[model samples]
Target: MQAVNISGFRPITTSVPRSAPYPSSARWRLPMKSSSDYGSCDFSCRQPLRISSSFSAAAAYTSADGETTLIQSSVGISDLLIVGPGVLGRIIADLWKKDYPGSQVAGQTLTTDHHDDLRQLGIHPISSGSNVEKFPNVIFCAPPSRSADYIADIRSAAACWSGEGSFLFTSSSAIYDCGENRPCDEDSPAIPLGRSRRTDVLLNAEGAVLEAGGCVLRLAGLYKFDRGAHTYWLSKGSDENRPDHLVNLIHYEDAASLSVAILKKNLRSRIFMGCDNHPLSRQEIMDYVNKSRKFDKTFDKFTGTDGPLGKKLDNSKTREEIGWEPKYKSFPFFLGVNTD
Candidate 1:
């Protein structure tokens, strides 16, 4: 299997440009552990970009003059049309609507034959469920390995689409043919799967999207709502090494926000990473969860298979180019640190 967690070290901050990105400090707080548990972060978020008050409204793409104009010019929300209403898809759509209330955003999903939900959410679902004909920039979060066929369909009929926007097909880091101990990053080079249908299909689909002018996002396991994988595993048992395995989970907030950020950056024909910067083994996580457990339920140490076929992914590109940093940047808080 691929390496179990993201390794190597890089300071998580950027050099301040004399002028500020926000009017004051970019007041965003990292998840706080109990004074007894997590005293502070182990990694360095030190770039002197620290500010106060507004984390969500801060800009990483600003200039020396400290103006929002430059940031908008470099990166701004783009019109987005997402495919599939899987957990990931729904979260991305919700974030887009919340962040860019004025932008045109619609989702193409497998119809549930009901208009009430879509109507209430103000989302347009192309329930016709026919092949995707056209879109400004299409994002496919479909899980099946054969989902690539849909991208091929769109490519085959490229003439139908305006051909100026982008297409971001969500793929997993599992394409690397990994094991349990070794870890991998974006530039680590993917191990050829020969004919691994799911990984292979993603490759073909990526080629088609790039050929037609778009980008690919090789993502890590995504967590959100109450359905988070880390949260599920953490709430399990405390067998010491119970949470000892390295974890690479991406918060749904970051995944969805990154999709919007990529489009805003106007990138084409490239790939980027989307995993949390903090690396915590499964053992440590489960302990934290059990200690913080609320409802008083008996916990069991979970062990079956090693883990998913994939491991960690590099996330630097998403931050440098797209100005997209995860809301939940650490693991314990990435899942356990719910804003709610």
Candidate 2:
């Protein structure tokens, strides 16, 4: 990828290459965890970049020699649109609007259940039959369950988008087929699931976004505000299959803020693995959640199932590029927060 300049900031480019297909493997199970939870670009932000008030804003003062000085000017940008405004989408939309008041924010959803809610929040609802309009920023958070057609829709809209900033698509890290317990980055070999409709659809979606020169975020599991895979499992007494496998997670608020930061910064990294800095084994998480929540839910240990497929997702590059770090560092830490 080549480097380019945008608004005086250097942006790095990102690209994904085609790889030979691999045979299908057994579906990896969500290990029983205690219930832990958890950029570059020359683009202008929604508002002028402001330094901390504690710092003096003056560029410089004349010394013995009367020399004129200058302080760097901050940049700002335009509006945004979000496709598939689900839970995460809603949070993103709210945060985006909060950060960019008077910024035209549009939202597209498959249903109208939340139309009133979105309208109250000042997000303009977009219908499927509506004419395509481009904005300076765009985010696609559609699910793979919508099928490959969902991907096609994003590609079509992105192709016609008038924005020069960036397009970001949220994808799952399950694309990586790691069986051994090791960390995987954006360059790691992705898992190939032959004949699996869901896997095929998601992979195709990622390819479509990348091909469009847009950003593809491979996010780890998400948990926040009484919702999460671990919470569901604990409530259902789900079996603990992979006690040793590590689980990568990010808080809902953190994910939303991170995406906003990327767009505001107009970063160039095409592919990013989004996760918290810490990775915990299933057993450790389960114990922490069960103890913290006082649930004490028990899970059955496994023996013969090819030892559970596990992997660690690294998000250092993503953090470095975006210049944002997660507010919640680990699932346990998140749960321990005092709501009061």
Candidate 3:
């Protein structure tokens, strides 16, 4: 056995003789809690469990001479291909590696601009139009803005999958037509295709993935310390903000964890929602930020109130079905404002 240098981690590798036949099944499972225990367990509190499984499956590579070669590799949900590995995708990759150190993670980007940075994070970078191997597990995190045709891009990514594992598409909660601050869930009706262009794109993309037996994760407004709705509000300092409009949010890390959990579960043709389970008005968010004094800049008081009030998203069903919970329970929780 030889060690392969993957960023800071060294995953063991072994060379197999060409004469040996490839193994048929190479499935590996991560240590997961029972459905009842998952709700009580905190994903952040657990240590990364080491996998004792070895790669027995072979990958086929064709040479210039048209000679086919078999290469033995490790088996698990560990072999992941993330299409459009941006902020949320990167977090998901890092967290996935933390849990399964032997995992082989690759990210597909439009250009080679972030290739080096991705390598530094132990993720192999694959540029668009480049030849790549089929991955057992695939997640499409690319937004519609990145492509002229979002549905085609998603279908193409699905075609690249091995179909032996899970395929997940990250959709948006905005697709839900709950504009009156009504509670929305996985069963909530989405905006019909012709209604809103933005939501229509997402809804069409979700339909494509679902038609292909893939999972769809409709995520809420994603935020982190310096880049969430709060930061944007403080920077704008505008009076045109809608104070009464509600917003649901999820921390980037929590979204990432929930993604990995769903992928590990390997559910197909299912729709899941991700949110911090806290819906606050724009005014409420700003007020909390100002009172906490987390930032130096103070947001201007919102004066205008004539915009669509955002929906209140409830992912309780999502939590129970996936057996996962958001580590950052709410925006206030992430801000260190103890609600309890």
Cα-based lDDT for every prediction: 0.49, 0.60, 0.70
Candidate 2 residue lDDT tens string, 160-234: 334467678888888877757787775676765354455566666655555455667778888884788676656
Candidate number of the best TM-score? 3
Best by lDDT: 3
TM-score of each model, in listed order? 0.64, 0.72, 0.78
User: Per lDDT, what order, best first?
Assistant: 3, 2, 1
lDDT of 1 by residue, 1-340 (tens): 1112112212111222222111111111122112112112111111112222122342232212221111111112244556565667777777777776654455544444533465456555543223222344567677654343454333432222233455666767665544563666655555442445555555555444444445667777776646565456545543334334566778777788787677565555566667786555665555555555542543567554444433545567457767777888766674364423
Q: Determine which window of 10 residues in candidate 3 has minimal summed lDDT.
A: 20-29
lDDT of 3 by residue, 1-340 (tens): 1111222211111212222111111111222222222121111112222333455565653333333333333434467889999999999999988988877787877766777888788886766554445567889999888797676677667666656678899888887768788888767766655566676676667655665557788899999989988898899885685789999999999999999999988766677889988999999888878877889899878988587788989988788878998888888888887554
Q: 30, model 1: CA deviation in Å?
A: 39
Higher-scoring candidate on lDDT, 2 or 3: 3
Query: Candidate 2: which pairs clash?
Result: 33-286, 34-285, 34-286, 37-331, 39-321, 39-322, 177-191
lDDT of 1 at 95: 75
| Model 1 C-alpha RMSD to native | 17.7
Model 3, stretches more than 4 Å misplaced?
A: 1-77
For every candidate in turn, the CA RMSD to the true structure comes to 17.7, 14.7, 14.7
Off by over 4 Å in 2: 1-77, 193-196, 294-307, 337-340
